[model samples]
Target chain A: MRYVLIGAGPAGVVAAETLRKADPGGDILLLGDEPEPPYSRMALPYFLVGTIDEAGTYLRKSETHYDDLGITFRHARAVRIDPAGKTVALEGGESVAYDRLMIATGSRTQRPPIPGIDLPGVHPCWTLADSREIVRRAAPDSRVVLMGAGFIGCIVLESLIKRGVKPTVVEMADRMVPRMMNAAAGGLIKKWCATKGIEVLTSTKVTAIEDTGEARDPLRVLLDRGAPLRAALVVVATGVRPNIAFLEGSGIETDFGIRVDSHLKSSVDDVYAAGDVAQGPDFMGGWSVHAIQPTAVEHGRIAALNMADGNASYQGSLAMNVLDTAGLVSSSFGQWQGVESGESVERMDEARFRYTRLEFDGERLVGAICLGRTDQIGMLRGLIQSRVRLGDWKARLMEDPQRISEAYVASTHK
Target chain B: MLKSLHIDPGKCTLCMQCEMACSYENEGLFNPAKSRIKVFDFHDRFVPYTCTQCAEAWCMSACPVDAISVDHATGAKVVSDDLCVGCKVCTIACPFGTVNYNHDTGKVIKCDLCGGQPACAEACPTGAIAYVDSDWTGYDKMRRWAGKTDSGAAQAHA
Candidate 1:
């Protein structure tokens, strides 16, 4: 059986590797749209920080890694996929047949509706090309404007700062990293960023980016709540949406992202979707596209196993966000928004930037958010994911949430 | 020059992000018990424990089947999981107590620095954990020693 994997990002690369290992005799074809070798997008920050070169971002270091595994790597974008015939048509009218199809096309950066967004000085910090463009313009003391202060934006913020650019970050949210962090946690992050010399404008939006008509530095950005800022380069890290446009009317179901079942199989036969593009089940018992790398890896592994062996099933994915903004770390784990009637407890030290908010439903921890309290993150994640009852320890946790490690040890020791 | 994970107990906030990242990289799952890097919390401070990739290299000397070998690129002692016999000899031989056995894989596992780019160091938000030149671990300990000796301007002015 020939297995065709699309979009050679983390999901596709892992899928191809998993498939090759699972079925050595099967024909495996991995297609990537980019010209570069299959690299980890997660390592893009490391690349921008000069710790590693562009080649270091590659998933496999050896040039002949794919060839040695007998997995064919092709550089092509899938324009259309016909699940009925299991044929994928490429951009140049080329078609490839496969017995099993893995859709791991990943995501694309979202472009907000703002005037002058298509200008030369403006770009998205998503791909290697964008990183190169950013490094070129974001020289030391260069005025860089980042449009969003969300998750991806904060990640890029570190790289931009490390590159010695004093970036003016503009976010529409009331606080930074709103999606991953709560109001208080997000506010603390914003304060930390301001302390680190980054000009953060919360509750602000970029209305337009006008050209200064200069060749060297030519961008003047207009904001909703602030003064017009001069910019050498404006990075629009607004957000990302899955690449599911091609699957429209292709008989596959899509809700924000391509819909896949527990087995990572699409609605149609033998066709599967994984990674950012797949709307798989959430650990909370719903469905959503988790664009995180860990989830994508799990999706790829399980999806590959299911396709090759058809005995594996996914237990759903938990929404886990671990972020570092200029050295202040914060994380959110599973249903952090809290369940109704759940007992919530918080310990905040705004002065020290240390905080922890635990949400417990009856006897089990449904969610948790910790700012400056990162060491307890692993235990909190285990507690939430395992859905283990806090039992008599629940009272102690309610009394002092900082005793999470004790609780974890006590409950699991037996 | 080779580098090692220099962990400052005081700098750690006990996030355990390093542990999760290490476990995921080595075990393909986010299981902390499976994690090579263990973060011990003593309430007053947090200490992150992991393989030192030791200069003396006791684990290397203890390995009988030669499963534990140094990765030439990273100067890390990476265990060849395929060749390991699960004897647990290195686990006892290592003075630092970093190397341990993995019951799931029936092989010993430890931090291999992720083949030079350690996920633990990369995942660490604070400078609590750093992959610095082994020769320079003393540099952080005596941070301003050279500056004091050279000019003595900042401290000598008093």
Candidate 2:
């Protein structure tokens, strides 16, 4: 029983470990396009900011541990997969056969189509190499032009501030983290960023990057409406797309990402997809969504269990985003919009830049967002996950998240 | 008679409790990147390396301004930032790459055992790290095996 897993990111590594644990006698092989072991993609910004060293991003257990567990790690790029033959063809024209295969190829950062985009200083925070390259080019007092107000972009913005570099973040959207969070929460975060001396340009786009004559700083970015902003470094936090390019014509069936059933098995037999690549049913809405690390990890674990002959079905994916920026913690779970027709409850203090919103569809919490005081995110997250009814404690939950969380927990006992 | 601080790499999860502890103790903030004791992770190897607080201190000898001195009580090499010229000689002298120069403050920084009690060991959730006595640091491992191997019934079952 040979288990071959592609992409040595978090999902791949967790799947391999889960498979090893479930079936110890089975042979497990983990392959990654990057030359290094799996690292925490979330920590790359911190590394770029000098808050963590280059090697600190590694999340995978050392290579020696993998060897001890009898997991073969092939450090190479997997270019093609033949589902019919049950084989994965490597980039260098080699093939590896597998009885069961898990595709956890994660995602790569999307680079917008703009001239001078191929310049040496342009970077994205999707991989360890990207972080290293960004850090090497960035120095104290370096002006950075970040093109996105997404969670990943804001994280990089915060990291630049920590590194004592001022970042001018240009977002075409009117608000920050628009996809994962609401306008009010985004406004709170934007105000916080302003207080930290970060210049955020909303509803703006970068038209072009002009090469400067100066030797010290080599780039000047032209905005849609404003004058050009001089910058030496640029970090594009503009989201990411699933690494599903290899599945072209393999007949696995992909919309934006590889579509999987509740069992995480793709349309093709003996094949399963998890992590950022698997787009499946929504936990609440039964819609397809992508790019949540926690969901991907859970997908891998469940897929591995079912692959090992254990009965496991992936319920669905809840849209969740957690951001730790400059000592400020922000988390959004479930739906951020009001399309679900939930009774919304909000607690806010504009001066402190703190806000909490709990949207309840009748009595059960459908979605929630927390800012400033995010220590209760874990408690509230469980509530959202369990879909517990707020009932009588709804008003009290707005005042203090802890109180409602406790009452909910207490009710569970009854 | 002096004792030096030792770290067990196997116990380190790279959570950076030590770095935070050191930074907060010295700089009044929670900044690990600025801390003296840096945890180096070999991602491929799954190991973290930190300062060993050597008995024969090379960093102490490398200091031209005599800013880095050996604490008689703890056998720990302490850096006097006021006297440090920031020449970074101590950084070059250390064999283990434990000693580092902070470009922000223009001085060299290294682990000083948190003035005899390390907060990192205290903050560690999984006791992968500990600030043990210099002489008997291996006692924890001995105790672990003792519980497993000491029982006569256990050995018979094995």
Candidate 3:
């Protein structure tokens, strides 16, 4: 049967590979818009920082490897999908009929309505080309201005610092990574950034970037309030929106993203959606989520399994964000926002520079954030995943890290 | 005669132990996303690559502030964070693409051989990475073949 996948990203790659594993003779056709072989979007920052070479960014397999597997990977964008006709129309005006189709269109970076956004040296960290452009314009003494202090923003900062670029981050929110982390946790992160000499302006917004002279010289960054910050390069890493406009009038349902059932199958026949573009029910909070790589990976597996006639469900997602800053580790899971009857357990030693907080909602652990000490996080994640009843361990957790550590060790030991 | 971490791509498993160790030492966390010694996996080929630490260092020469210098004890090229300004010249100059900037600390972080005993080499589970004497890395491979041909095989038969 002919299986045509829309994207060549993490989700699409996994789906195609899984289909191959399930059925050897499965005629899998993977279509990608990006010219390069499927590279890790997660590693783009590494490439910018110069730790990973250009060739190193390629995902686990190259284009030739996919060819050997008898999987047809076409570098073309799907302009339209004729679900009624049971065919996918390519950008070159060619149509390929498929027995099953997977839409893993992924996402594009969200650019806010700000002036001078289209100007030179202002970029986002979405595509590999964007990364290359950012690095090309970067200099040792180049004043760098980064808007949005979210996960990608922080990661960009980490990459820049390793390459000897001190970047100033401006967030519209009151704290860094506020959306993912709670106020208490974000406070610690802000303090860490301050200690590292990073100029983090919270509750601040960039209005425009003014550059008249050479691109190497300092460009003035006009803010909503106060004086303008000068920088040579500016990166907009505010957030990402799902790529769902292509599915318009295709009868494929979409809300925030392409809505999919538990099996990752769309409302349309012989079609599925996954990755950052596919919106599914949240695993931990029962809300809709879009941008988690692990969830996308799971979606691919589920889509393939259901397509290959296996029973599987897309078991939601845990909004997990892991960040490693200048000598600091930060992680946030589940809802750090509204917590009903919230109980918190914390272990912090300013001398050792270690801090950990496990947030529990009544009997079950719901959310957590950790820094410096991360060994406990792996276990804490388990507690949240399993929804393990805290029982007496909740009280003991407040005073001792060993209690949770022991529980983790004992559970795993079995 | 600057010392640097020589990665044998054949030995890398992409376990990210080196990244964790590097971040832990510098950033005090186990986040590979922020590590200096990034392990690039050419997934299809299963190759892990890092810095080669060339003799004629482009990064050292390219540093406009002269903050990058050779360590006398280990021969490793070190970036003095205090003296160094956050300029990305060294990052662009390094052909191997091992040098990187940390946004949080506003400094460059390269493999300084981890003071002769590298944490990445120690943390590597597969024995794919190892620190050898600068001049004698190839000698160990030669000795393995020599043992099989000249003495060990013949002695066992006798």
Predicted complex 1: CAPRI docking category: incorrect
On residues A32-122, what C-alpha lDDT tens digit does candidate 1 reach at each position? 9999999767667767888667886776667998999999999999999998888999998999999999999999999998899999879
Model 3: residues with Cα > 4 Å off, grouped in runs: A61-63, A348-352, A401-403, A411-414, B1-158
**Ordering by TM-score:** 1, 2, 3
Q: After superposing candidate 1, which stretches have Cα over 4 Å from the reference?
A: B1-158
Please provide TM-scores, in order, for all candidate models, with all chains considered together. Answer: 0.75, 0.72, 0.71
TM-score of chain A of 1: 0.98
DockQ of 3: 0.02
Task: Name the lDDT value of residue B72 in candidate 3.
Answer: 82
Candidate numbers sorted by lDDT from highest down: 1, 3, 2
Best by lDDT: 1
Task: Give per-residue CA lDDT, model 3, range A272-335, as digits (tens).
Answer: 8888888876755354755865566667767887787666654466666667666576776676
The lDDT of each candidate is 0.78, 0.70, 0.71
Q: Give one clash count per candidate, in the order shown.
A: 4, 4, 25
DockQ (C-alpha based) per candidate is 0.03, 0.02, 0.02
